[model samples]
Target: MENTRNVLDFFQKIVKEEPDVSAAVAAIRTLMNILENFGDGETLRGLSEELRKATEEMKKAECSITSVQSGCELFQRFITLTSLEQSNFKDCKEIMKKRGEIFLRKLQEARPKIARLGAPFILDGHKILTHSKSRVVLQTLVEAAVISKKRFHVFITESHPDLSGVAMRDELLKHSIGSTLILDSAMGYVMESVDLVLVGAEGVVESGGIINKIGTYTMALCAKEMHKPFYVLAESFKFVRLYPLNQRDLPQELKFSSTIIESNHSNLLDQHPQVDYTPPGYLTLLFTDLGILTPSAVSDELIKLYL
Candidate 1:
């Protein structure tokens, strides 16, 4: 049980990495290390049980779609290890190590491919608006601006309570990309001038909608109202089996209780939500490692990968 808790803690800790994918990747590497340290059958069972517990723990912690999906992916690999032992393959450690490598390589290879595929949509002179920060979104913008020389201005919402948008603005500046930060409520005010909307997803549900930062739905609604195309830049791993008809169906982990107000203003300090779902109709396309996908095509992709 102790080891199980440690495994869960390790996954949750690494998930705090700036880009959600980096956090997922870090957790995968740490899991690899954990597997590498286990050489015998008896302790391996403990680790295997711990892996199952870790996945459950992830659900409670509200890990992002990629992390939870990757946990499932890892569990599949664990099944392979057990199968190998039954087949009398004695070098179990070596087999597990190789499996981990294949999985890690698959994840590492996805980021750049997604960026490259998504970059072309950011044409010259396009003023793109994004809510919250996403490493994939940032990388796509950078790829378009730097390597492709696509000159454009980026407008970001100051994703409140966390202000992850500030980090995004700074990152854009670091890459020599131009960006402007705006207050969350000012989205509609600026919507008319924006050519497109680009945002990252915590999870892309089976309904062809995305679960992203709290303001994403509002931003999408505004974009939809203005006839502006809203694009979601995400990897396939962020796709999940959930089909939420409304916000309440989402897991509790997606919400946060920040002490936004304190002391004298104690009564005003209500909990803040961290994410919300944007229906498929609000999005124009999803740029993923699987290529440019229509909102409705998300389910097909999920079926292709998981089934």
Candidate 2:
């Protein structure tokens, strides 16, 4: 329990400096670990209360440090933290649904600016390509489609192992939005005809690199080769400070998952891959809730937040 509290405190310190999804997630995960490891009902309740207070403090700090759009991202982070810390599974699901709603609201608020100033202008019948599933990007496109009063064709990559793009396709279909699901390998072939590429990041480092679901870096490489515009939609909180120390030491964390190591057969081991890193230069623009930033600008942004 002491070790768990120490980890939680470490995450909280990071959150105080960089109020992004990564830090918020770390905090939430640490809290969840405490609950999972120490199964005392009263203690769990006390930790939950403490986490709730921390979340509120994080929010107040975020609003003070960033713009309204950034504030929205902070709110989403809080909602995510709250949802994860919920003791009841049913309540967690309900909170997740509400979190999605809050995310949608934030995306809606930033749509006009993102369409006009963030991404390149799309012609009347332009097709936009996207990889994986991003609620933020999806909501942005939906808002664009509605504002344009015309169909905006979207090509979505069927993210493998997860196939989250399937969910993206279904959501688009329900909204009567035009969309096509393509194999992840087909991204390069389809790049030439697509107007722009939009992706979401799980984390963005001060060095301008980003961490996302597997296949994002490949897409960015393709976009770079094709001279196509590739944009990342992420909140500033995702920005991390990753500097090497003493030329011999570097910060690293091991993410262990049974899902990755244990499979039905050894032959099928390579089938399920998770996580990839996208270098910053390949990204043309990062559309944050704060505003648009070039990949080069990420370091400066992080400095402002960290220093």
The most accurate candidate by lDDT is: 1
The top-ranked prediction according to TM-score is: 1
Compose the digit string of candidate 2's lDDT tens values, residues 6-109. 65465566656663334344444434444444433344346456555544334332111112223334444545566667776556646655665555455445
Query: Model 1, 90-209: lDDT tens per residue?
Result: 366567777778777777777789899888888999999998888999989989998999999999999997898999999999998988999999999999999999898877888899
Error of 1 at 144 (Å): 0.7
**Cα RMSD for predicted model 2:** 11.4
Q: How accurate is candidate 1 locally (lDDT)?
A: 0.76
- What range of 10 consecutive residues in model 2 has the weakest lDDT sum? 247-256
> Candidate 1 regions off by >4 Å?
12-21, 43-47, 58-66, 69-86, 89-93, 256-270
